[model samples]
Target chain A: MNFDDTPEQARLRAEVRQFLAAHHDELAHGDGAYLEEPGHERVDELRRTQAVLFDAGYMGLTWPEEYGGGGGTNAQQAVINEELHRARVAGPVGHVGLGMCGPTILRHGSEDQKQRYIRRLLRADDMWCQLFSEPGGGSDLAALRTKATRHDDGWHVQGQKVWTTLAQHCRFGILLARTNPEAARHRGLTMFVIDMEAPGVTVRPLRQMNGHHSFNEVFLDDVVIADSERLGDVDDGWRVALTTLMNERMAVGGGGGELGVRSDVLVSHANRLLPRLSEERRVLAVEALGRVLVESLAARYSGYRLQTTLEKGEHPGPESSAGKLTAVRVAHATADLGLRLLGEDAVLARSRDGDWRWASAAASTPGIALAGGTDEILRNIVGERVLGLPPDRPRTPAAATATPIAESR
Target chain B: MDFDIDDEQRNFAQHARDFFSEQAGPEHARTLLAAPGEAAPGRRVLAELGFSSLTIPEDFGGVGAELLNMALVAEQAGRQLAGPSLTTAARVAVLLADDADRLAAFSEGRLSLAVLDGPPSGSRPSMDVVGATHFLALDGDDLVIGEGRVTLGEPIDATRGLGYVELTSSEVVAQDAQARWARARQVACVILAAEGLGAADRAVEIGLEYAKTRETFGRQIGAYQAVKHRLVDDWVAVNQLRSLVWWAAWAADHAPDQLPIAASAAKAYCAGTFETACETLIHVLGGIGFTWEHDAHLYWRRAKVDRLLLGDESEHLAAVATCTLHAADAAATGELQPI
Candidate 1:
């Protein structure tokens, strides 16, 4: 029941603080804005920073030692992450690469694949993005129409992937395409490591409503991928994809301070803004701020519960969905409170007097529910998986006839 | 580094759950409700479970377990709609730790003490004190245990009636009664919150179960997004409340400086969550949930009462706000407080 760190964890925390302090000037400042900002120079600097972190035994701390990780517990990794976040320093670059892609490779990839990819991914030599969502299949990801036909030497993939975050910056992507049209929706798909530079593959950035080029629409047309690049067996993409998606939820769900504005920033904003409002509005403002604070605490503590699960050497499952859902509510509440505090000034576009923070939050926070998984989809996961509720629809006839995915896993 | 209940605490909770299920379950609560003042059953089981002595020190003839350990039992008590017996005992034992004979008497069920919920200036309402002989109330800056005359009000939760009391004769329990009373209040908050958390957890489970089994329009109602998502939100709130209860319990046992803020947060959050959970339970249960026969109302009543007991949700939120402003970093870094 103790929350204090162990002696070993404390020592690691001190070391991490010292290391972060040493690289304070070189690190990305201001709470991970650089991770979303796409530029060759920014990415190059990020790559070098990641390499330095990997060298310092901070990156991939919880991965197995055989794969060049530090072979440390998640708690130790958590201490480093907390210190890094508190210091406003950048962690490993290419979050998709390190958090989702690298972990998928370690768990479901072949020995050769693990050997070739794990270290490079950790060091950010090859950045990664997920190409799971398509224009036809956002929440219904299993219904993706992406086709990957077999070839003599490799597989040729052709699909349009929407909401491909950081695709323009990524060198590779974990693509889920239908390798067998004859099979069930979930069964026919296959996961592959598609080279973003392959011929006929195009990455066009999507301008977000907040005017950030953080998302992309990747068009894959006759893109050739080597046979060895397949992440898992043919027609078993759903199982492999689950591994990556679970990690994505874990990252997004347990990802505190990474997703939303800090509560303190909002508190300060309230302190500054509340004095100008009417008595009625001020009371409403205080209530809104308090609600945000409460939800933020819920998100934070639930994240700790997730951390404790990882610390106990258990893979996070649907519990991560709850954290993700709570995190979204916190973000939404903060954004709503932000706008409420601004009064009529909230309608003004980009008022340089720090009013933009709230406006930007309002714009960007909605997209968070869309990312990782939609709020509705996540609730389904929490309801079905965590609470053992029945699925919304009966299994498809083909799925009913086929082996249950749970059994296959 | 472990921020979870250990196996011993878990076992204690299981034991509490088993005992409550066997003795003080909703059916028993209903029975007590039917017969107004039937001396709420299960005092022997409560004694056997050692709940009364849970927070009392060894010098005071008690197990001297952490407040968290007792909180686990409190959660179970809430789940079964067990009355406020343990809540009262927890506050009494903490406030009367210096009085060993009184602690033993309370533990052995020879003394029945109910905590008064009001200011020190005047008459206070002692909740769920149906057959209590004495009351622990604030007497102008001092915590006093006194033989009191009661005026029982029409309790919303008839299973545990509410009563107003006037101190007929009194004695200060401790030297530093005010400070000890503050600690007692914090302990009460955590235990009540834990109980609310348990009640919320059960209420959600009841909804989920009904959702899974009950069919509407050729499908399980839970299969629909509207019902299922609402149920999921209930589940999420229960989980969140569980985190707060654990954290507040931990703070009470290990971090006194952090206890006030943590306890207030737990109490505040637990009120809304528990109330929401009970309401969601009824809604998900559909028609059966609204009936007087249904156990959902018991939880609803408890949540309504618990919310305003130590302090209402808004008051606790205000306290949390003040604490956070005083130590702004505590709210930012949720767990990393400077001990």
Candidate 2:
């Protein structure tokens, strides 16, 4: 298997290197991919940085040129991501819009939706959040009770969605709601692009154990939506959602650099920290290092394999989901090990007095496992799709009997 | 750039599986063990199939192929638990190729070296030594090929016997013994790791197949998330195992400088994967898996034997850490030469 970069790809990588070198000072701090900051400020910073990347033609290199993308290949995208990962750039913006929502819209959105959303999303003009999982719907996502009864004007939506990442900053969302109660579980839903600022819409931040607020519970109390906002046909939301979900796997699977952090960094950290640790803890650290290294190498190359397939103009399919599964585990485990190795200073968000600031800052890593898809869901997908195993029994969803959300927790 | 083997290797693997399945496989392992210590039939098939000469150069009367082709044979052997590895001779033959007589004899299928499990133990046990004229051992940094004075014992895995070879009068095959040891060790790692991958693949298949029929709580076990997730993870591990095996085997032939770390990583990873998979196969097989009569133990036996055969998982992982981290640290400091 040849993984050598083509000359053109090498040239592009050099260009990206030069770009990052030039912008190193400005990008040394946070990229704000999370939602801890004010929505307006986050959006502003994202727009500015994204505008620079857009002008540099590094944004959406793999997307077709019609959507303001560079119309390059997945290899280019992989190179760009590798550079971005090396630079440790997070952002005040969410990648969901560009990676998931935008692609789904481009494939399924009406002409108006495509023209209105693709360019803006690519330019990071507006952050987007997904409103698919409801308070009652996680693993059994199709059993969501969010109702979108038909209105004379359009549809009046009433639902509460949980784990709505970036909803506090999002101007728009792809919302899934039950449109036909009489239809089968997966056949009765519809997808809509709801304005987060629409009347009766509310977003309440969910502060996590990481002490960060990256997720939100969104309440839709009779939120009115125009029929034009609908994505795909009525009762065809499952197909549209499938596109987003598949793209979500690709995004997460091929996400950043495989290991979130480099082995050199971990090695250097060990070289620095091991001297001060006790014998028992030193052994523990080595064990963790072994796990981290195995996972990092696997994830890094798995991502490359996915890119190879993507460069061949094929979707990553079920195999790529393993990347996300492995990555989320690695990211969280490394973070946990970092905090434990921090001795007494683990309570603080990070150390200004020490070197594991990045690791300590990984407090937010647990969120990654749930985002895109839960670990169990991904495992099931890998089992059923990749291994050709039988799907879980098609029993009715446990949440199918839940009462409609009354702004429930 | 593809991460998969070429179509030729894939086809060869199918042929190997077909041949071994028909003649010598896990079933063959049992039948062969009934006669214990009689490795003639297996050795004969290997010679006829040219498996023993896969790595020897054409000048020495061999197929003169690379480790990738050898890996296909090893993988199919592991998949079916088919006989002892003939890749052993192919490995040491390439390393000791300067010994023209030994190389010629091995290439002509008249000579073989029973490779030993060279842990730090003083009394190391050799394997597959039934009809071999010489025994090879790696003692510390020394590469010794023994000629006389051997002690035999019952093997942990009955398919192969164990023996101790005296190295005091053995030949020093190379002046740079450490270098030779490292080279042969990496190539051997490739072949064995591929076998581990095959075993893992087979374990996953066995588990999934059993899960489809074995019922618990009035439902097929495969329908349960507990069983299904374990099999899924096993499948994932098998994929990782294959990837690493391919990389190691590829590196052994094309990137020798990178082979040390690649092979160590493959060994470290595969050793664990194979053991875990074989254990899981027994778990999935339930009561019968524990019975000596069931075939599950044979795979488990081979997996356990293969793991500790070269070096245990921990030892290999230590090597992985040393080789990889040192290389990484060197690259970071601009000390490493380009691969």
Name the best candidate (by TM-score).
1
Clashing residue pairs found in predicted model 1 = none
True contacts kept of 1: 0.63
Query: What are the per-residue Cα lDDT tens digits for candidate 1 across A298-360?
Result: 778778877887788899787787788888788778777877777777788555485566677
Per residue, candidate 2 scores C-alpha lDDT tens digits across B14-65 of 9888877776666666765665664433666776687777888877767888
Indicate the DockQ of the complex predicted as candidate 1: 0.62
Q: What share of the reference contacts is kept in model 2?
A: 0.38
Candidate 2, which segments miss by more than 4 Å at Cα?
A: A28-47, A254-263, A278-284, A344-352, A355-362, A394-409, B38-41, B117-123, B138-142, B167-169, B337-339
- Per-prediction TM-score: 0.93, 0.91
Task: Kindly report which residue stretches of model 1 are placed more than 4 angstroms away from their true locations once superposed.
Answer: A31-48, A90-92, A255-258, A271-283, A394-409, B42-45, B119-121, B329-339
lDDT of each: 0.79, 0.73
Error of 1 at B183 (Å): 2.1
lDDT (Cα, tens digit) per residue for candidate 1, span B127-162:
656777888887767778888788877667765556
